[model samples]
Target: MPSQITRQITRHVLTIPAQGGKPARKVHYRRCGQGPALLMVHQSPRSSSEYTELMRDWAAHFTCIAPDTPGFGQSDPLPGEPEINDFADAILEFADALGIAPCAAYGFHSGGIILVTAIKRRPQAFRCLAVGGYAIWTPEEMRIFGESYLPEFVPQPYGEHLAWIWSRILEQSWVFPWFDTREEARMSIAHADVEHVARTVSEMLDAGEHYRAGYGAVLRAPRDIPAPDAVVPPCLISAYDGDPLQAHIDRLGAMPASWSAQKVATPKEHQDLSLAFLKEHADTAPCGALPEDGHEGWLELEGGLIHWKGAKGGRLRLHRPAEELADPSKGEIAIDVPGHGQSDDFDDMKRAVEASAEALGVSDIDWPAPPAGDADRLYPDMAPDRFGLYLQRAWQVARAEAFFAPWYEANAAHAVPLTPEAIATPAVHARALARIRAGAAARRWHDTLAQIQGETA
Candidate 1:
């Protein structure tokens, strides 16, 4: 294991009046490194805290600045739910307020959506952009997500909600694997751990009703950034298999020549790859090389040792403070998936799985058998080829028993009042069943069985 990097940095909180009656604002930002400026925009339901570690590393090369977007973390909410354009303008204003001209910007997920919009609106403000997992949902996909926006899976008694939320995210890969390659997809799934998944789910739900509202705003917004063809700066859009944005890669693939696209397995790898590309291609350059630190953590599935400080959260220890990550060692890098450590919301589950797998060197491998006792009895007659599957199923059963059972029992008292027309409705139940069947069919159980047989042989 390599030693982690230790660096000192400063954080500043500025209250910039919103442009044109939007509202007053208090923005907390961290400044580090020396040289060209780099602004990192975090995704929705999260704060500037997401990039603490990455910023320390990147600051070594450029002055890295990360801010909490409006309506997230400590930043004041936008006046009445601003659109993507509002976010773009807010970022532009943030730049001007900080006196950072012609700075390079990077955004992940919804943050990417906002930055791309900003670049299109004011091309001169940014010199380059690196976007991760940009979501461009198809019409039908949007419809499904809109309907399922407030999933009833919020865990009861709070504690179980953690595991419940984690399972919901883990089950998502069965629906979509957005990477450009199988290796990327496999590596991405291998890095998640139960604790990380639980924490992220808990945070998103804790954000109160605003969580659903924020999601609704994005879902109601237009599909593409209003100006897809505006060529202001060199842009790189990257995605991995488990990334929800992976489905939208085709949309980005159609971007004008100024933009480029690639897929990597993990978030840390994506950041490193993007930084290396920027160092080579982007005119704005980093200042100097920084030394490594002594942080160490296990990547759950991938079985690799990741070195960094603030291991519990997303903070990275660096030799010097900078605005963004400097060059890192080649190969996959681990990041805390959302809701765990410093990341916010349930979306971090995908990244966590990938990071854990990478740390543990367990990519594409089956999980060990369930421990002795009740766990063993629960699945005595069933077998799963992948460790994730077993864990996912166990979580689902535990959650259903823990949360839904009491609700169902209590509701029975009102069962007589429940009209025949009101009980979940046959059509809804049918659709749900159909979705389940389709999911099972699409999972290609036979393929997994074949792989298991091959391994045994």
Candidate 2:
């Protein structure tokens, strides 16, 4: 019989007094497991609830602490509309309230931006930092992102725009002109997973409009982190294949000496790498780990966790995946990405990717080559004026398809092969089936001709 996965944990809601003339606010948090301290920060349009599952697995390695950022989840809105820096201050207060003077930290997306800002302001307070898909958009890129990627505020009720919003977030890899390079284009198409996209969409919708503040702040804030060259500490930045931030790898590349960047193909890879790095270096300073369970899966990334062992202490095990061990060039580490398995944070894509690859025992992979052909010309029919909207729609469909394709393919094996009558149930369904059949027939014909020619030779 398999061992039952135990779900041991505790919950707390404490009022953390604001620092520097701000009023106190009720902060909701979850604490579990036993070990060093680790703090988990959630991205925009979501709450700390995102890490609930991933925390289970991490509890074995560290005392996981995940809090709902002010104005999101159960936490109250800030005394006033706050910027990313203000959010960081709230965390500092939260840390003080919990008696965590110096702890390790991890964050994803907007959460990462805040943590990075916090660490820059108080470098000595953190032992190390790991971020997923960190965005350091250049001035030009920020202009484009703001004009296209920022969600428009609509007065329509939540349900009305939920689907549209969800789709927009999911289909980002598809139709988004930002990723014009060949390798990114191919990987984006190949990695589209509709189910995952749908789930992410759903979660965002559930989190509601209050989450928009974080996104807005991220978009408007300047991309500036003073050099940590003087008080450098180990830092990791990671991202997956379809991460929008992947385009700004150069910006992140300029990180201080103590920082490293990596690009990964999936979120799980990011978590594992961050965890391994944290575990290896969790003794030199104070640290905090969130979501204590060693098996609880995280939101979106599924089987993920967060762990902060300390600054530097513990038996460091160098476990690399078999394929990675064979080829030392792959550069994958033997740890899990946060919110994917047993790790946390989602702000720095490159670092996450490199760390994940190392954790998985694979050597680092080269950045993918840009896509071939004229990317701008591919969608001529798309209105130039509304390119962002059109691309956003296309991206939505692509992500939905990516998420659902695997399940659909698996289920197809148990059902009867598609027949004209079966597909004719809906007009849209029939048209899609016809397209599939045509594509399949074309491939078969080409294969048959090749085989015949080979036989004759």
Candidate 3:
């Protein structure tokens, strides 16, 4: 059941111009409400989705805009090894692209580091800032984090990376600096709830090995706080009691007159404090219209927004049942069918596609060829399980699909022409991510495909 708040918020993808020799990239974001612009940045390894409820509440008084920071969610990675400065610059890039004229910003953990750097680089560009936690790590502590934290996350043949990532995130709540299992590192608040752990694990999957760059940048970043007399916008930095960073409030020595730090008793109080601070300082200027490429953008359907790319009247490329939009080079126009990719799930996917086409004025439809004889077997149950097998299952299908027309059939009769690219680690990993992201929605899409083709699902 979708909440009313979820409906009020809308998601979009903006194409940022090429930078530092890198090609143009897509940045996904969530927007809602109608007041002073508030740019919300989430912690590392998590996307804007984590702040859905927070945005909902803040939306009542402010235009909450939270973006999937570069290399985290649907946003593309930076050109190369990005330092704290690169991520900071990326934020300004997003702001300029979206035309949020001097907005108030908020950030948590790694997000806080980036925002701090951004404000220091261009103080006049922001109104104020509300930071959840500000870390002032000592050199010895940074060395320890550098040596033990953020292991290289290379994908494994049997989805071993998936198991490791799930445990890594699950244990993060149990202990600070997850790799430190010692009693001293144990967090005051800890739980192993699968639902919560699953969300972080999925985000880790999206970031892949780039987690090291983002996470490391934060740990290695020096405390960039300015002197009390330095010119800067007003900022409030607060942390909840159980949070590891709550203790770091003491380390923020001699802050500027306009800045203050506090330790709240609970997360609710922490958020309430941040919200109140932002409200006090938030500018009354209007957040400009959301940027959109006239050619490739979201189409608002009755049920939900449909994500489409390329030319509208061009040959419409539909991906496989559980697949997302094909590579842009494959065709002029492609769409992630409802219930797959970034598009929202729908009760009637076939009709949803028709409605999307009608709305886009897309007449030249080019549907995908139905898969060979694979039923629900091709689309397994990918719900979060205690053992984290769903991740491996997606990997299994991804690997098998390369050699056989229907991944379930391994015999020579069903063997397809072998291609090196299909079996490559990166290719298989990409396919597995697509299947994992689709989740049980893949089954619904497969059933819809069967209905369209008049065959068994």
Candidate 4:
């Protein structure tokens, strides 16, 4: 047996074919390890980021591939109100794009719903599946969830949505549906950890209003598993105590002979069982060549992996702190500077930028103009507070910057002229998310640019 070896997870963008009226779009994915491909799908409102640690460990046994489902993470959304099949077919397109068909697979929660549908649609595409907590919702359960589960998540002018979502994701573990605070709704295992809640909140913020579509599609989907007599891939379905979907294991009465459901004592036990099941049934053949991003990818340099897009040399455009690459498709080479966007952190951002330009064979650095205000007041570091107030802070900062040039001075004297579109919800949401995600390093980027510009001047 090959000893477990750690592999660095690499991200790539695969273009899925256009469907319905929607145009073709990029699907961001993470890959690790080397062996037969094992496709993993994540639950709703969360991206493939959930599989990072698992991918690292599983890398020893299989080539793990996980993609951000549409409208989640960096992947784009499908047009209109897409149903279960649309998402299932999208998964197929994703797998086909990589030429990794008939691969071993795993999915959790909403992910289980998607992969189950995909396997049923084309059994030959997968060799086996390991599902975590499959749901077989009763009509009454569906009706109850339908009424209160997915509230339209619109961004509010006063940061009301920020507060609402933070609390909602935080309380999700406290109660089954999160919204229902009644004692009957409480879960056996509950946690109020700031770190865990913050991560879920961040992913939720990333999904935005599109979360409803992905989540609703799964909640309303019919029994995702195929009939007992149907030919399908070898599979194992399991759930642990405290999981809401564990009860649904009993609901899955008649399944294919190759598929079996098990109740585990703990999450670790469930994962352990799934891993063993996958190892036993995993395909022996190695995965084929994977598609690569034409315009955007990570560039390894002195500092860290800097995410760059477009052909180099028109100009090396740099977005200032509290922001990321403005427009990647604007006929200019743009990079998510160190500690910003998708780029990894580096202490000396100036050196990082210089190294990037040198590698890209570009001399022109089109740096963004500096903000006109006290740096201290303008940049708050936007740390995650225990109550998650930092979310609202970032939101307000994004809004404030739009209305006032410095964002600290509330008076009309500092007011900047901008149209309603400039401060629109989507626009501000992007800005706020940037700030929340990378605002801590904004100062380093700002200082780096300032020094470079000062020397040039």
User: What value of lDDT does candidate 2 attain over all alpha carbons?
Assistant: 0.54
Give the per-residue Cα lDDT of candidate 4 at 274.
95
- TM-score: which is higher, 1 or 4? 4
State which candidate has the highest lDDT: 4
Question: Candidate 4 lDDT, tens digit per residue, 1-457?
Answer: 3343337777788777666667998899988888899999999989998898888878888889999999999899988898998899889989888999888999999999999999888999998999999999889989999999999998887789989888888888989988889999999888878877887888888888999999999998888568889999899999999999999888898889999999999988998999999989988887666887777777766545788888866589888887787666555899898888788889888788889988887898877766667777878857777788898889888888788878989889999898888799888888888988795798777777677778879
Ranked candidates (TM-score, high to low): 4, 3, 2, 1
TM-score of 3: 0.94
Candidate 3 residues lying further than 4 Å off, grouped into runs, are 1-7, 19-23, 328-331, 455-457
TM-score of each: 0.54, 0.56, 0.94, 0.94
What is the alpha-carbon lDDT for the whole of candidate 1?
A: 0.52
TM-score of 1: 0.54
Q: For model 2, how many clashes?
A: 112
lDDT of the candidates, in the order given: 0.52, 0.54, 0.84, 0.86
> Candidate 2, 438: how far from true, in Å?
44
lDDT of 3 at 112: 91
- List, residue by residue over 1-457, the lDDT tens digit for candidate 3: 2346533778888889887686798788988776778999999989998998888888777878999988888888876787898888889989988888588999998889999999988888889999999998888888888888888899987778888998888898998888888999999889878888888888888888888888777777779797899799999999998889998999999978999999999999999999899889989876667876666667777788778887666667788877889655534677888877778888888888888878777786666656667565777798888778888888988999889978888999999998899988888998998887788777777776667677523
